[model samples]
Target: MAKKAAVLMLILFVASLLAGCWNRKELNELGIAVAAGVDMEEGGRYRLTVQVVDPGQVASQQGGNGGAPATLYTSEGDTIFEAARRITQISPRKIYFSHLRLFLIGESLAKRGIGQMLDLLSRDHEFRTDFYLVVTKGTTALGTLKIMTPLEPVPANKLFSSLETSEENWSPSLSVTLDELIDNLTSQGKHPVLTGLVITGDPQMGQTKKNIANIYTPTQLQYSGLAVFKKDKLIGWLDEKESRGYHQIHKGVKSSVVFIPCPEGGKVAVEYIRGKTNVKGKVVQGQPRIDIQVEIEGNIGAVGCKKLDITDTATIAKLEKEVEARIIDFVEETIDKAQTKYRVDIFGFGEVVRRADPKAWKAMKNNWDEEYFTHLPVAIRADFVIRRIGTISDSFLNQTKE
Candidate 1:
């Protein structure tokens, strides 16, 4: 009987503690941030824009049609922390960041510096590390958060899907998360790249506010090229073609399509199936010299040659050589521009030199950006193999021998 009485007291004690929590807030009392954008404001201040979810509408989706989707709020301050605090001025309820799916930085802000903006994200305990980070080109960071995506019920979900698709089709367009960005910033060997976005529209529509579109993408955010950075500051932008070449040389480029001009003066599209780049770094006279070998195999998708037969070994071999030459030209041009014009090691060649010849890198580590990368000797060789000619073996224009 004494044991039974003790057990009854324990149940009452648990019930009392569970019923009286003062920190609890009603669901409608908080504004959940779906996405965040950071940009450089005038007078050396920073601007923060947040896309807040409407819980009432989001939760009632099963029975009712989606309403207003998400609302965007903007705030400006000297720092990211201060900017976030200023958001409370416009926000009716407490701003919660537990559901943030994407973070965008304007090109101007990225060029100025992202380390300061990202500091708050890393130190904050409420933010998750999986949020996608993108660089907005020709658009303000705040503007990127305002555009609504079609098909997706929520704008944040659409942004997430855009990044995911880039990874599967064009690997150079791989998505970078908060955790990965932080890691690249801390690592001395490599510099992180972010996807670029732009706003486009019909000028006559008069609804220019909804014109935001990632240019590389026909529909949504595009992870097309690398945003070359000197440490944390963005140096320059790489075009889509240049970005693909950079991916082939330094980053992970699983599959990509290249349009090579045929002998008959039209376009021949070849889609890559397997690609591998091998780099060899050698030290000579206290300088770094690197050799890059790219091997790719793909099948021909279309042929514009009027007289050439794809099944012919000679014709196929010549086509393969021409494709290899085009890839080499593209790769060399990108590297030359990056090294000579931008002077940033966004291609990660510095990492290769460091890993290959530690002694040379150690001696040249202090002045790598200025001295080493500028004068570093780089040799690139490309080899392409046409594995298959699709379903039709010969070109339609080829004359058949009876």
Candidate 2:
């Protein structure tokens, strides 16, 4: 009987110990974070900005007239953790970050190196690996969060939606999630790239505009260029033309248009619908040789030259060659500059080499960038097909000429 009593007491003791709760935080006691920004502050400290959405306001504004768009709150500390902890003192509730959509790292911070900031994010339990990591161009991280968007009730949503559309169109820039960036940073023969955003005009461009046409202008968002990186540091930015070339080489371009200047003092616009690139490599006499084949299908959207009859097979063939030549020029320019000027393997060419010849990669893996890319031989071939002309059978310009 005494033994039975002892067992019951032991069970009671264990249950009582487990039932005790400490440091329990209620949902109402915390402010949920949707977007976050990290920037460099004066005196070598970090400034952390957070966008928190009010649930009351969010619930009230369903389709239109949403609650106070989004509120921006900021804090500063010696370190990222310290800055985040300081947020609690000013904010009525603790900050929660389980639903973060985007993380913006300032230009200055990016140049200094994102390796350290990444360490803090990786250690945090609330940060999800799937959230996007973007670099701000020509602006501070806090400055980007200041603008309010007109279309989606919040500016951040507009920015996030632009990323989705970029994938559908032929844009060289790529969006990297926290997980993907970490993988590339840690992986061999692979480098990381992030989509870039620049804040142009004020958010309320057409809030009180008198002209009806001007109303739509303010609602639009502009996405331009990409930031090239060497490991974790920002190296340079690519122009729109260079970005197009990057997309072609990396097979990231979905659809875009090209305007070719004809000899007859006019232009022809070609809308590219489909494009594919294939790269093959071979080693000869201790030299690595690469061959690139790009196939493109497009339609002639506009023609200002009267001499060229696109309907005729010969004329179409000539036009196809001209388009192919233009693409080849851009591709070569991008490859040459990246190889000679930047000297970084931005096209993942090293990855191609690794996949094709694992034994060779293992042998030269230590200095692939130094030994292979510098003296690497690359051969390029391009094919462009004009699949269809516009809806009109004959050009208006041709009739005018006649």
Candidate 3:
């Protein structure tokens, strides 16, 4: 009888413990934040801009009030956490960040350094590591977030989806999550890079409902060049070409289009179907060297040139050579810029060397970026093969072009 009573008591206790949800927040008392922006205020203060979804408006079928899907609230304090906490003074409900998609660091804040902001984000259990981090180009984080985007009613969602799609189809832009950024920042060899966001057109109209009402959005957000960083500080910017080169060198590019000048004038557009890049690092006679070999397979997307017979194997071979040269140029220019202009090792060659020869890395680790990396000898080789030339071998452009 006693044994039966103990078993019953244990069962009751276990059930009690399992049924309750500890520290549970009811949906009614939570304000779900989808995007957050940080900008440095003049007095060394921090401004936190949060974009919260308007659930009812977002669900509206008839485009609710010109599709104002998200609402922005700004607050200022001495620190990021303080600014975040101050947001509650204006916001009715307690801010929740599990749904956060984007984190924007303003140019001022990014240049000043993001290590402090990252500390708060890393320590706080509220902020997820998966959210992307972007630096606003030539504007505050708030300005970048204020502009309403077309198609995706919510500006935050637009930025998130646009970056994801852009990275796949475009080579210049890259998407970096908080975790990835932290890893790169913490790593000894590699520094971090983030896609820069720019607000185009008039800023005043971007915040209004009229921004999305018209077919032509007077104001829009664009993912521009990659923001190069020496540690957490923004050192400089890489143009679209340089950014593409970075992508190719680091194997960040999945697929993209390359336009090559044709032999007979005009340009030939090619779709990169498959690409492979191999970066090897080694110490030869006490000097470090890097070898980058790239192989690409692509198909003719468009031929804007006059009189090119892509059907001939010789023609395809010549086109392949042009493609290879272009890729090689991209790789070489990116390496040269990294060595001379930036003088930072964003390519992570140090890590490659470390893995290759630990003893050598230990000696060069301290002066890798400024000394060794700045004058690192690099060799690049690219090979390209022309796949199927679209639906038709040659463009009708050849038939009519004079």
Candidate 4:
């Protein structure tokens, strides 16, 4: 009977502790920051703009407060932390950063160098590292944030979701995160590249609700070229074709459409379904050489060529050859620009060399960015195969004349 009484007493004690706890903050008292923009001011001051969601309105089915779903608070200071804290003057509650979805660094700030700001971003326990990072192409980070976006209630969510989509479906747009960017900066082998966004149309209209009221929004955000960085400072940008080549070299493309012109007629669209890239780096008699081999598998999505017959195996072989040439062109063109214009090894060829032979990499490490990379010998070979030709082998357009 005494043992049974002790067991009963233990159960009661455990139940009491599980019933309650302390240190809970009400949701109403916290300002949830969905997006953050960092920009450099005229006198080198740091400007912070945070998009805080209006909880009640964001959750509502009906339009809330003239269709404004979030509120923007801005402040400037000598440091990021100081600017962040100063914004509380306009904010009703403490700014909570745990939900941050997108982080924007202005082109001006990027040109100056972003290594210092990245330190604070990583050090803060409240900030999540997975949020997408981008450099605003033509405007301040604040300008991008101020523009209203369609579909997504929160403008930040629109940018965030679109970047995710673009990374998966598009070749030119590179989706970078805080952690990945930091890894590139801290590592000696590779430089960093960030996706660039530009605000389109009238800037004044973008900040208003009418921007989202029409079928075609007056202002929209576009994911443009990749922002090339020499260490932490912005150096140049890779155009669409060059960006596609960069992705190909890194094996970063998931799915993309390629357009190849017909020999005698119109263009044929091919969908790149699967691909493999091999970057082999070695030192040959104290000289560095990189051999790149790429294998591509694709399917014909659309054929605008009236005379080309894809049904014959010989015709398919010719098309495959064309595809291979295009792939090689992309790879070589990007390498040429990198060697001549940027003179930066954004492709991480140095890292590959290090993995293959540490001694060679060490010898080339100090001058890899400018001297060695500019003169590095790269040989590229690409092979493409058409796995399928979609549902119809020949388009009905083949029956029509030009």
Candidate 5:
């Protein structure tokens, strides 16, 4: 009887702890923000634009018939925090940022500095660091967000997917996350590079419902070149070729296409199979020098030259040498631009020096970027290998019979 009484008491205590939901929030009570854009307005204020998803429309099977997937709301204030709270005045539901996928900053705002905006994001509990960070080139961040995409009902989702795909396949642009940007801002001897986003057509038409009605949208968002920053402030931009070269030195290129001119009046396309870059810093006699070694392997993608024989081992050797030379040139050009034009160390060479020679790095850490990095000598060595020649060993263009 005593044991039975004890067991009953324990069961009653456990039952009391399993009460109703205390912190549960209804989905309808919150406005899910899929993307956020920040721009600078006149009078030293911030303009915040958020893309809030419509659950019913986003979840509907009959896509276009369900209305727009998201609606954009804008608010302006002296600070980002104030601007964010002001959004509640216009929005019916509470804005929630836990699901945000993209964060965009306008070119003008980026040039001014993004440290203030970054501070609020870092302190906010509702925001996550996984979302991609991008800069709107030649337009405001609000304009980029206004552009609607056809294939993906949600414009924010489209931007997120496009950024990932471009970074994986294309070499010109690089995606930077919130955490990575913060890291770059804090780290010494290195700067940050953000992928640029641009609106291609009429900005007004992109915000309308008719933007997604046709097979070809009037306005579209494009991933532009890389925006280079020095301590949270935008300094300059890198073109396609220079951006690719930066990727080569930074080991950002996963796989890309490289075209080399053939001996004949044609070109040979090679798909990058694999590439690795190693940067080492050395201090000799109080002088800094960086050695960059890159090893690349690729397969022949297309042969436009008819006279070039793919089966010949001599031809393959010559092509490999040519590829190596081209890679070296790319690295040199990028270093020159960084040294002479930007005068910023976006390559993280200071960190390399720090690790290699700590004592020497400590002495130069104070004025590394402005003094040492600008005049640092960089030596590039590239080795290339041709792994395969597509499906056939010999191209059909080879008319010479064995």
Candidate 6:
């Protein structure tokens, strides 16, 4: 009977060891940060802003009119870590970062240098590499975060979802994650580009709850162009068309619409369903040459021209040629801008050189962007195929004669 009691006691002790909470934190004790923003301040200080979700407001079924879905907290210190820890002085609960979805850097901070910021983020155990990285254009990170969005109650969620949708359907904007940005910074051949965020309406009004209650918002957050970076520093911004052109060369385009003008009149809109780009580098007698081959297949989405016949093979072929030319133009324009304007190799051309000729790349690695890449001759070739012309073979405008 004593031996049985001993065995049962041992079992209970083992079970107790396995069952208790090891490092559990209560929900009330945590200030769950869903989004964070960093801006540069005077005297070389770092300003950190975090958006902490209010569980009661966010979960409320009354459309969350109780209050803002998230509260903004700001802190300042010499370093990001210090600034983050200082947030506790203002907040009642401990700031938690496990739920972070978006990270924004102000234009001023990006221009000064984000290498140190990135280093802190990578070393921190609380941060995950999945969050989206964005740059605020013509505004401060705090200012950008303060603006409330109408469609999405949570501003962080709005930014995350908008970036995902834009990258999938639009060619101009590119989504950069924390991991991808770090990879680009560490890589010798490539540079990083982040989607730009802008506040369209009155900045002050965006902070108030009335901004969302009105039929039309007085202020709004918009995803602007792409912010180009050389290493970890912001160099410049690319316009909509230029950004799309950059995507064409780097194979960042997934699905986008292209409008081509018809020979007679009006225009035809083609929706690119699938596309791929292959960049090859060759060195001959010490001169580097690049060949970019693009394959695109799309369907006609809208026919604005009345005279164009969708059923005719010749008409389709002509439309295909126009699309091919447009694709080539996009690639070539981007290449020219990267070479002459930015003088930055955002296309990973240096990597292509490394793959094609490792010996030559080793010799040119140091001066690749400045000396070799800027002067490299590029050839762009696009092959575009039209698969279908929507549900109707011909536009109703053509049927007016019938």
lDDT of 5 by residue, 261-363 (tens): 9766789998887888999989999888899988888899999887888889999899898888888887788889989999999989998888889999989
Worst 10 residues of 4 by lDDT: 17-26
Q: Which has the greatest TM-score?
A: 3
- TM-score for candidate 1, residues paired by index: 0.84
Using all chains and alpha carbons, the TM-scores for the candidates as numbered come to 0.84, 0.84, 0.96, 0.93, 0.92, 0.93
Pairs of residues clashing in candidate 1: none
TM match of model 2 to true structure? 0.84
Reference-based lDDT, each prediction:
0.77, 0.77, 0.88, 0.89, 0.89, 0.89
RMSD of 4: 2.8
lDDT per residue for candidate 2 within 13-127, as digits (tens), equals 9998889567677879878887898988657889999988777765564633533657778999889999999988888888888888788888888887888789989889989
| Lowest lDDT 10-residue stretch of candidate 1 | 202-211
Candidate 2 C-alpha error for residue 151, in Å? 1.0
Clashing pairs in 6: none
lDDT of 4 by residue, 302-323 (tens): 9987778889999889889988
Model 4: runs farther than 4 Å from truth? 1-23
The 10 consecutive residues of candidate 5 with the worst lDDT sum are 393-402
Clashes of each: 0, 0, 0, 0, 0, 0
Give the C-alpha miss distance for residue 108 in model 4, angstroms.
Answer: 0.7
